[model samples]
Target chain A: MTALEKKFVSFSVAVAVLFGVPQTVSAMHIMEGYLPPAYCVAWGAVCLPFLAVGIITMRRLVRQQRKTMLLLAMAGAFVFVISSLKIPSVTGSCSHMTGTGLGAILFGVPVTTILGVIVLLFQALLLAHGGLTTLGANTCSMAIAGPLLTWGLYQIGKKLRVPRLPLIFLASMLGDLFTYCVTSLQLALAYPSAQGGVGASMTEFLLVFAPTQLPLAVIEGLLTMLVIMGLETYAKTELHELREGRRGLFHDAE
Target chain B: MTRNKKIVVVSLLIVVLLIAGPLLALKGASFGGSDDAGSVKVEEITGGEAEPWATPVLEQLIGGELPGEVESLFFCLQTALGVGVLAFGFGYLVARKKYGGDRSGTAGDKEKNS
Candidate 1:
């Protein structure tokens, strides 16, 4: 390898070591076959409309501006990296960030939906972290619900004239938290509590996820802010176009 | 490092601490997966009637579960592929800035003319 390539490889290794060392066998997604066939089909059906819209939006954006393809790939990559890091938490349980916030902030909800489904699909097929049967339910919670919240928060924050960095942090962090909330709800719906019905079951699942996810949300937010900062510094022109609504992804961008 | 770089580094250190501090202080906490916890809770809630009814396709093909090492390998490969693409995007953008010399204006002009 050339000197630059060597340096890049070493840097990547250092990153892998830094994040990968603390990992345990903690496959935290609603694992394969965890949901019943009926619930699985229901969730999968729910995703079809949103995914259709997402694909349409993505296609329009790519046709309008080819540069968006690069940013889209980067956003997808961010999701992959962030989601794979199953960080340990104070609850003595481990969970991972959804990493959908950055994309939601940059490209809005529809594009994020597409990015999320692709990543979830890979995890299901390759790593067996999530299963194909459960992909629809998982996609609904992690991709659609999470990014929707993030995009909404970002748009609202912008309207309120919130500072950029903290806004990014809150939107990203809350998006991660909200993904788990939706997951808990899905679980609760699938397996309602006999004693108190779906509410009690949902609360139980939420409490189980909260302690681990709270810290993870904060970490995801910070990491997302750092990435945005890096992009603002280096990819100024591209971000400017994206933010300007030239790509027509964000409502406020116009 | 520049001031901005230092700030980024320190923030990263903070992130590291946030992750490690819990693992260190918890002292023998199983660090179990919440997904598993959720499953166990479901079983308890349903009086052990709610077992997962399907197996992963790969596991079905192999007639067994994937080994932990292989699972980690797949996860690493996923992360590596993502990081590689992300790096390429950033590198392309940076290189464009260096060589293309502020072409956003021209691109916009071209769009307007078209």
Candidate 2:
């Protein structure tokens, strides 16, 4: 296939899985049995080198500023703590922050890859939000799509020349939405049910998760944007240095 | 000079975070575990059980045994690799284009990178 055709096919598969398929499969945490051993092993193996690469990149970023490293670590820790402290949402479910949107926006995708690995490790080890066997899938869902989509939305916003706040906000919002949507799609694809299985139709799954997730995405996006914008406005010096890489932005904001 | 600029930015980020680090922490302490611990609560939902393409695999895994079939393993591996590579490669390119430095350079001029 041509490049455009390839892109189109990929896009169609994503949409088909996310919106067109059905069932209430728990895609995000990726329940243990849902993945084949080989898939898990292969992904886990591939993640090994990427994890090294991520560490190298982070070390380079950190060597520039020890405090920036500490701050990012703290930010990651804070995310772990807050997300673990889940709040009640719908009757049968609870929700927590994914924290990927802002992480992607500020640090870029490479660093977010590291951040994702760390966050997932902590969440699994300490909080038990996700299990160890399924860590690969979880990392792929949040770390991969979260940052990728965040960067994509940011570019779209840049091309449109929207204001900085709106740009960041929209980017974050869409990033969060796509992260959850992708996770849902991943689950559906992993576990396709018969016509009358417990898994709801893809549209039904979308309807169920979308209401809560869409609003949560907006909330998270705004929160992240506001924090970033607040630093930009009131603490421009800190932000300038942080953005410049001399000082970390979260260091001052926190 | 450009490298110095980068260093300066990184340094500033460190100091700023050091000063502002505590605020990122979630406050207050939980004195006790949540009420739901060890409680088996049945949730009533409005959906029927759906069929699965890999129901046997799912059942086996849930039952604490890995699937013995090689086809299942290949299926999962193929999907995982495809998605993993897509996620990593595309994600890297997007980030590089947006924030790695300058964006004026063309992103996808050659097939090798893609």
All predictions: root-mean-square deviation over Cα?
11.6, 15.1
Candidate 1 C-alpha error for residue A80, in Å = 0.8
Q: Write the per-residue lDDT of candidate 2 for residues A199-227, one digit (tens) a residue.
A: 45334344445544554565566556644
Chain B TM-score, candidates in order: 0.77, 0.29
Q: Cα lDDT for residue A174, model 2? A: 78
- Model 2 chain A, poorest ten-residue lDDT window? A245-254
In model 1, state the lDDT of residue A78: 98
| Per-residue lDDT over B1-114 for candidate 1, one digit per residue giving the tens place of the 0 to 100 score | 896788689779989999999999999899877888888988888999987778788888888989999988988988898899999988887776778645665676688889
Query: For each candidate, what is the lDDT?
Result: 0.80, 0.49
What DockQ number belongs to candidate 1? 0.54
What is the CA-based DockQ of model 2?
0.03
**Top DockQ model:** 1
